[model samples]
Target chain A: MRRGFPVWAVYALGFVPAVVAFGGGLAGTTGPDPIRALEQTLGLWALRFLLAALCVTPLRRFFGVNLLRYRRALGLLCFYYASLHLLAFIGLDHSFDWAEITREILKRPYAFIGMACLLLLIPLAATSSNAMIKRLGAKNWTRLHRLVYPAALLAAAHFIFAVKSWPLEPLLYAGAAVALLAARLAPKRRPSLEQPHEA
Target chain B: MLIRVGTDLPIASSEITPRSLWLRRRDFLGAGAALGLGLTGVARAASPYSTDEKPNSRADITGYNNFYEFGTDKSDPAAKAGRLKTKPWTLRIDGLVDKPADYALEDFLKPFSTEERIYRMRCVEGWSMVIPWLGFPLAEAIKRAQPQASARYVAFETLVRPEEMPGQRSFPRIIPWPYREGLRLDEAMHPLTILATGLYGEPLPNQNGAPLRLVVPWKYGFKGIKSIVRMTLVAEQPKTSWNMIAPDEYGFFANVNPEVDHPRWSQATERRIGEGGLFAKRRPTLMFNGYESVASLYSGMDLRANF
Candidate 1:
């Protein structure tokens, strides 16, 4: 168990929120509004996993922690949570009412932004496999995965707009997204050639 | 705590239904009719109306609240309102009333008989619940005050104490302190308008507006101001807290209309509390929250324009 953690563990961990939410809902433990609680929980976990996936590179570069092996798994898990979040909105909130769903998409800015983020994640989730990486080539694969940054920002904005008031929780998530993106975009430091060599 | 069981209340034969039967069904049916009806007779006879929907669980009703003075979070009121000192509370009735007077909490509630009112509470945020509130009609109290002919509107105000209510001290101020709401004089005098004092057969929990509060079922939940401290009969429309903060988003006549959507969200559907799974299906919202009895009050008025 110490040598290298199984990727299946990450997959298993990802399903925990869904199970807990459903279980809590059925058992009457999700307070007065179980559906809203469930929807919010799923969406929050998706955002958290997306942020975790974003942190993988920054952690390795800044803190020298190598979690590269689990990066893809984390990304896939983020996509999985996002899919559930979308399904919860469409099936539970809207009850497959296409007309109402369309009207909501048109009226609610947050809903539109959330939908856009999910759409961007689809291609990344589809191409997460080793075979797809080989087919696309390393450079093209890296380029395609870059969509995650925008997706993360949009998800953060979606969270902020969803609430009635500007509470600290959504603001904190938005701050983290901004800081992570700044770190990713910052110029890489290089050793100066003009500096004298140490004896 | 007073546990008013279904079998212990007198109910009208016409009011008995599948839902009411389910509540009073098993025990009352098996027991003799005289014994069963006799017990529930007083409560049922006094209560003029009630909803068919099952009341939300006591925990849900008290645990989830929206007393903004305590805080903006739904759970904040439940967490913070325990510190509120409700025993020494007083209510002031003034303005266009001939007999303006201040009454202590006990004295304020002494004159009227309390009865259970099961109502559908729909929040502007698109969530809904059926609550069983125990209180006397607002008209009973208003009648004692003797409003003059000039009194066209009634204004309600909540208690304001920053130390007791932390949200009042919030920097940048989410809402102006001493939350206020108003209703047309006719609306305030309506039979459905009540000053709630208890829930689930117990004195109202602090979070759920202890001592006294208003329950205007036909309007959005916010219109039912909490922990009321003052009532004034006025000649003009009074400024309400939400309308003052965002006039466009919250109108004075904050009636529940599916067609009139909030600027940020749709009002067509609502997420019913304690129902469905994580993605609970949103049921279509009814006009005036299904209180068609009060429809005539808004006759000839454009709801969209007024909204």
Candidate 2:
């Protein structure tokens, strides 16, 4: 077996819990509080999958593990989970009441932030394909992908604000993300072989 | 022996006619439904929990809840409440009461026959539920306590141990310990309101305030404190849990009036729990939860401020 797992395998594994969670929610099989269980599961998976996608770059740089092949797969999984999260909210809570939904979007600050995050992810997901990346050019694609950083922050904020009274869990995730980004920015010693080749 | 033929309590007369009993049953069911027992299984005329009864249909069980003891989620109480320590519970009735006493759970509950009353429970968050509650009037319980003339208001306190309830650890310290609720003497003695010990028949589920809880059918659910540990009859209005947190948002008289909307959201409409899909239509909320007969009591007072 290879030291590294395949990207497709990782993606398949990620979807398993999410699909089961959604199915359980739809089937009303969640033990007692089915609605709450479904909501928490969808939201947790979306954030967890998004964090996994964020880790790909740092993992590659820090450990010299060139798992670039898995980045696209992880990114796709993030989109899938986020979409499922949105659908769960729409299907279970709103019950398709457009008027009520519009009211909630306007009234509740968390709903607006969540929708904003979802909107930002749509473009990123659409352009995740190799063909789209080739069309956009590598430099332009990198700049566009940077949007994920803010999207993650916004998603975390949505959770924090929605649960106005409790913020510990969400705060922990936000703090860790900030630390990860800080690690990315910290100056790194250049490799002797790369410096000689450049000179 | 005091004989209750149908609904009439004949203290001295023992010779009861079948026609009198039938008439009394008719008066009891018809008047009781109107007076708001909202009883179940009986016909619309003979029973209170009828399909077409607007007031009975509107009592919301979903929104009006303080599940903070179980977890932060709105639905947490229904699930996590099953684990609560409900047995061997006692309610200490003291302070300005002529008969300052502690009643055991069974003895406290034994005197009255539990009746199911459906009421709309509106939450500050903007949702509502129609719950079928099993209990007698709050007035009956308080009368048994025999409050002194000094008792102008009744204060209720919930259990506060962090070990028993996990949510206590999560709440902001600013929120007062042992969630409390209060009611004016008249409101406390309102015939429509109930001191609920059981719900949906049998004993109350823990999350639904097992053992004992108040059911103020007219007011919001938070006014109905669950897992009550103490009942103190006081002269002043007690500081309620939500009101102390945010005064403007939650008020003392948390009546279910759709007209006086919450600052964060509208109270004009509510989603009937377990009724619609994600796209289910929201039904229009009623004034005073359709308790027009009782609406006049608050006519002169500022409902928005009191809310």
Predicted structure with the largest DockQ when compared to the true one: 1
- The pairs that clash in candidate 1 are B8-B39, B8-B40, B9-B40, B9-B41, B10-B40, B10-B41
TM-score of each: 0.85, 0.77
Q: For residues B216-302, write the lDDT of model 1, one tens digit per residue.
A: 999999999998899999999999998998898899999999999998789999988877645577889999999989999999999
Worst 10 residues of 2 chain A by lDDT: A28-37
* Residue lDDT tens for model 1, A98-175: 998888888888899999999999999999999999999999999999999999999999998887655568888999
lDDT, each prediction: 0.84, 0.70
Q: What is the DockQ score of candidate 2, to 2 decimals? A: 0.23
Query: DockQ of each candidate's interface versus the true one?
Result: 0.46, 0.23
lDDT of 2 at A81: 78
- Which portions of model 1 show Cα errors greater than 4 Å? A1-7, A191-199, B1-43, B148-150, B169-173, B276-281
Off by over 4 Å in 2: A1-4, A31-40, A62-67, A88-92, A188-199, B1-66, B73-84, B125-128, B146-151, B169-176, B257-268, B276-281
Each predicted model: what fraction of the native A–B Cα contacts (within 8 Å) does it retain? 0.59, 0.07
TM-score of each candidate's B chain against the true B chain = 0.88, 0.79
lDDT of 2 by residue, B4-59 (tens): 21122333121343433532454666666787876534533322531233322211
Error of 1 at B69 (Å): 3.4
